[model samples]
Target: MFKYFNPNKVFFITSKAPKYVLILFIIVFTIGLIESLILSPEDYKQSHSVRIMYVHVPAAWITLGIFSTITLFSVFGYIFKNPNFFLISKSLAPSGFIFNIIALVTGSIWGKPTWGTWWAWDARITSMLILALFYGIYLLAWRIYQTQDQAFKVTTIITILGIINIPIIKYSVDWWNTLHQPASINILSKSSIHESMLFPLIIMTAAFALFSLLIFLMKYNTELIKIKNKGLDRL
Candidate 1:
């Protein structure tokens, strides 16, 4: 599946994506916004501003998810010798970088009220910053190297090395004392949240997933056209 990710395949699918996904994204996202801002109960402890969780958590989740995907794409790019996989990884980075910024900024905003400070040099926060740095370097690696092959290898190596940070980001609260709170919606165990709050969160996450795909499809299509124009259709 990864190896066969060619221009024809990407363009064929992405060209039709809006026809299928955009309306649904808008509707679901709007509903989620209403639920989060108007209907969902505020935290008894944190009050109204807890609504930031709707944005912060989803952004953080997608950032981690996209990077994991980029790492897998990098692995398959090498194993299958497919440049299309590399392009897909490249296409994903810009959006992922933006989401990473959103997560950090929102986190700091949330932190200011909760922790009484805008920034803290704790375990999870530090590791997340490292993850952002890794992402930054991965994006720059593509431009710093002149040739496609060199850029691919350098970025791939960076992506692979960066995988170590993902687990640390996830488990940092457990490994050490941190200002950041532990996970509330655990998959391995029962979630600590109520259904009312969880429903909006789930809806928001789905909407984000849709929007992220929509963005990636557009970016992927752009890259496909670029490859075609460069006369590298065989890649």
Candidate 2:
């Protein structure tokens, strides 16, 4: 089964996906910007500054989502001896790290106006920062290790340990006294965010997801090329 995942075979299919993804990304992102910036209503208190939530929330969501996916791929790759999984995980890290930074920066920008501070030791904020650190360490492991086996094992361990932080980050606001507000969107119950704002948030999230997919394809293709250059037929 894993033989079917050969880099050559995979590249033939995935390499063609980026161009289409890029087109869709541009269309969705333009719509997201219009909906978020021009259509979404201002918060009763925060006014225009509230618009930052469109970016901050979606970036945070993407960061967490990507890390979870990285963890799954790493664990499964290690268990199944699938080098392709590691390649995919490695390709995903750049986008995850990028979104983590975006979330943190935009959070800080949103904070100055909302919390009246540029930075704080709030639980959610602190946990998010820790998640970003884990992303850094995971990416660093790939570069620092000389062998694929070594990198795979180390990154798997890092992701397994890092996943424990995900729950903490999700529940930090509820479990502690934090400047960060509790979640506005709930899966099992009615969300606090109005439909107008929620619609744009969802669109922005979709746009961001497409962008990450575009990045992953580009990185994955490069890795495949490297494998080909090394005269390897399969990953």
Candidate 2 lDDT tens digits, 1-235: 7777777777888999999999999999999999999999998888899899999999999999999999999999999999999999999999999999999999999888788899999899999999999999999999999898899999999999999999999999999899899999999999999898999999999999999999999999999999889997666
| Clashing residue pairs, backbone N/CA/C < 3 A, model 2 | none
List the lowest-lDDT window of 10 residues for candidate 2.
1-10
Residue 136 lDDT, candidate 1, scale 0-100:
97
Candidate 2: residue 14 lDDT (0-100): 94
The positional error of residue 25 in candidate 1, measured at the CA in angstroms, is 1.7
lDDT of 1 by residue, 59-110 (tens): 8999999999999998888777788888889988887888889999999999
- Give lDDT for model 2: 0.95
Using TM-score as the measure, the top candidate is: 2
